[model samples]
Target: MSKIVMFDMDGTLLDLSFDDFIWNECLPERHAKIHQLPLSESKEKLYQFYQSHRHTLVWYSSTYWTKTVGVDVLKLQQEFQSKIQARSGCIELLQQLKEQGYICWLVTNADRASLRLKLDNIAIEHFFDVIISSEQVGYAKEDINFWQELQRLHPFNPDETIFIDDTATVLKTAEKFGIQHLFNISQPSSLKDIKQHQDLEFKTLDRLTELLSILNEIDRKDNDVKIA
Candidate 1:
C-alpha cells in the first residue's frame, strides 16, 4: 500500500518569515513611498485590503496585488529573495519520507509566480513527486474545489493521505474533503511566537522531522491490525 503525504510549501516546509516580512514590512514601506502617504496610513490601508481578501484565490495572486496596489509585488519579492529559507528539519523530513517510499506532494496556495520564486531560492523541489500551485486549480486551498480539482488532475486515495499545513482554515477544508490525517505547524514563522498546540484544531508538529516518528507509529499499528 502507498501512503501519500501532502505538504503546504509556505509556513510548513518553508519558513514563513520571508512572506511576513515582504507583506507586513516591505510592502507597507513601499506603498507608503509610492503613494506618498504616512507609514501608518499605508499599513492601515493594506491591512483592510488583506482582511477583505483573506482566504480567497485573489489574495494569493501577485499579479492581482500588483495591479490593485500599484506596486510590483512579485518584483519586491525577487529583490529580497535572499531571505527565503526552508524551515528547520525540512530537508531531513523530506529525505526520510523519500527513503521510506512515501509519495510526497507539494500542494501550495501560492500562485505560480510566487511558487517559482520560492523554488528558485530553495533546492527542495526535487523531493516532491508532484508540485501544484492553486493558481492552476482555479481556487485556493481554503475552498473544497481546490481539492476536488486536484483529485481530478491527479487521483489519490484521500483515506490513505496525510496533509500538513500551517493554516487551520486550509486544514478544515482538507478534512471536509475526507483526508484522513492532518497536521498543523506549531511555529510557522521563526520571527513569530510558537503557537500553543492546544489552541490548534489539528495535531501540531514542532519540528518538521517529528513526523517521521509519528509515521512509524502509525505503520506499526497498521501492521499489528493486519496480523490480528
Candidate 2:
C-alpha cells in the first residue's frame, strides 16, 4: 500500500489570514461592543484567555468560545469568508499527490461547521480522502491521547505515515507518540515570516516535491533491508 500523508487544514493547506482576522479583529470588536469595554481592553482580555487555554480542547472549541465571549463565531466566519484562501502552491501540491499513489487526509482542530464553511469558501474539499476533526474524537491534537484514539479509529502505519502541520505544540505531541515522518510549516500565514525550528520544517508547500524524493528513498532503503 502507498504511504498516507496527513495535512493540517488551516495553516498547512490553507492560508491562515482569515482565522487571524476573525480572532484578532472581528471577534474582539464585537466583544467590546457587547460588554461596553474599550476595543483595546477586550482584545487584551481575549488574548489572555487564549493564552490560558493554549493547547487544550477548549481553545479550539467554537461552541465554548461562542458562549464564553458572547459572539456568533460561525456567523463571523461567514462574514469574513472572502478572506479564505489556499496557501501558495498548496493546490498544486495536492494535485501532484493525487497523481502519485499517496493517500491524503485532513486532520484538524476546527469544528465541523467551521471546516465545512472554509471548504466551501475555498472550494478544495474534493482533495482529501478523509477528514477528521478533534471535535469528533473529543480531544485536541496537543493531547497525546488524541493521537492514540486517532490510531484506533483510523488505522495507518506509523512508519509509513507523514504528518504536516503548522503548530509546534501539536507537532511535538505527534512526535512523542512515535510518528516517524513529521514536517512543520514555518510560515503558516503570509503575514508571518519563516520560523526557525529544530525539526524538519518548510516555509511553503512548494518544497513538497522534495519530500516525495525523500519518501522514495526511504522506501527503497526498506526494500533493500527486507531483501537482505
> Please, what is the TM-score per model?
0.98, 0.92
Native-referenced Cα lDDT, model 1: 0.96
Give the best candidate by TM-score.
1
Global lDDT of each candidate: 0.96, 0.83
Alpha carbon deviation, residue 183, candidate 1 (Å): 0.3
Per-candidate total of colliding backbone pairs:
0, 0
Estimate the overall C-alpha local distance difference test score of candidate 2: 0.83
List model 1 lDDT by residue over 1-228, tens digit each: 779999999999999999999999999999999999999999999999999999999999999999999999999999999999999999999999999999999999999999999999999999999999999999999999999999999999998899999999999999999998999999999999999988988999999999999999888887898899
Model 1 Cα shift for residue 85 (angstroms): 0.6
Candidate 2 runs further than 4 Å off: 197-210
